[model samples]
Target: MTLPTPMPDTPHTSAAPFASPSAAHAPTTLRAWVCHDYGGAEVLELQTRPGPTPGPRDVLVRVLAASVSSADVRIRTQNLPRGFGLLGRLAFGLARPRQPVLGTDVAGVVEAVGRDVQGFQPGDAVLGVAGVAMGCHAEYCVLPATKPLVHKPARLSFVEAASLPFGGLAALHFLNKAQVRAGERVLVIGASGAVGSAMVQLARHRGALVTGVCSAGNVALVLALGAHDVVDYTAQDFTQTAQRWDVIADTVGASSFATCLASLNEHGRYLSVAGSLMELLARPRGTRRSIGGPAPERVQDLQMLVDLARAGALQPVVDRTYPFTDLPAAHAYVETGRKRGAVVVVAWPEP
Candidate 1:
């Protein structure tokens, strides 16, 4: 896990504004927003709790930022796609939250590491997916060092870093499932949303001719984000388009499997993050498959995201930023399903 590194007297220079909670009246136990039961955002309650310490292969991170994604919403609402209720309850909780604090996307600094850990030291800025352990919405959280943890790229702010893990990983997974290749034709439905937006950029980065489907208002925005062509779903139906795609990735399940099938060229891939029953039934159609059952969590993929961001090929889309304490409003806004991209929560306020 954590490679051996010397502890620094100061946090990374850029992270100075995101001062650790331990700086002021540092308490042994940290304040955490906890979820005891599954319900709406109202189920969340802010309470002081004992701080988490690193395990032998884990690192304790002072959370600087976290993201409110569809997974978090699903966990809170107990709505785990169709037919996944039992499995979801098993992984999450039967009647209550298995992980109490439901946030997976994390951008933070190493506060401490376990005895067996290396490659990290106090004040090292880092970012990664916390997975189902879901303890990111707090002043401090412990993360497995073996996962996709990496040093935060110098180019992105904490909010931007927070935005990448969930959406970026999902998009990367589905895109790879589609096997996007150079000179291929890629179409991304729900292009204005988080995963779809990342899919557009990654497909383009792979040298595909990218087309994006979104609302009329987001047409220019999608185009600016590197979509070769923009389809306004409000005014037109993409299923009726003349052009065919080599890979059809639907992030919001806005298009049916039949529509995606008819729109795809022979042997093309149809990927969906949110799949309908019809799409699930269409899985045997040879080219159709539903993605996002599990997210992509490979460290190499995380490194690719960092490299793309550093090279200015991929940019994290942050629709809005909410203070860590305003999670209720953040959840309420995400429920509206109108966010342009990712919504971020700043766990640690800027000093």
Candidate 2:
């Protein structure tokens, strides 16, 4: 459960790029998971590719762990919100992925850095989301020096750190936007899921009265994550409960947005992850609003999670870890909609 601490000694940063890996470990090419076409996990094929070289402002990370998030699944299956399909195709690819790799969140060691890079070194241990330029499913990937990358918390493993960025950043963004504060009643649907789990912990840390809605099987998991109360959706409908909340976060879009909005107290916040076509039509135009958008990726936001982890307030839950070669299987597992927190794919060095 605990991860080794990175050496606190200030790194020797420079405008000049770090040199290539020593001859002992140097290799001209590497293996990576490439998504040639998008439909399902079967489309992700293992292929050989030229190794990546850091740009003038990039750091090449030797990925140790990469997590398959809801974003990855949606993008792969074209399960996007209405009117976003064309945008997705244009940004990603018409038939296959533009970058070909699927992972966005990763925890790894910096293998090299570019001339203009600073605040990191060739061997710094770090974690972050790669955003739109995602390619973390490979053994190596590049991250902008100014992106969400941050030092891995001392007590978090590569797998744990890898799991935090996408979910943590999302929950933090929506919860903060909702003006979460002390003593407010907060309810998180899909509370045992990636974003949902993070919301539960963050709301609790912010001194809110936290209630989580999950299946009966995951009731204990949500409660163990600091949710003050847990609702088993399989046994009862959370929206039908008599209690009202100051904030209702539908981390997963499965719940009816309108029904949730009606359940909030006057002037309460409704934070939906995205605009489901049905939700778009029912959106409020007044004080009782429904806000949904992409979760922003920023280094400062990712660092906040590290600070919380150090303070013992945030801990990323890892549901399962698969070998890098088993990414397709991992994807299949995630598609089943049964994972507790996150499903991670760990890299194995090539022979």
- Candidate 2 lands at a TM-score of 0.90
Q: lDDT values of the candidates? A: 0.78, 0.80
TM-score, each model? 0.89, 0.90
Residue 205, candidate 1: alpha-carbon lDDT? 90
List clash counts for every candidate, in order.
5, 1
Q: Which candidate is the best by lDDT?
A: 2
lDDT of model 1, residue 218: 86
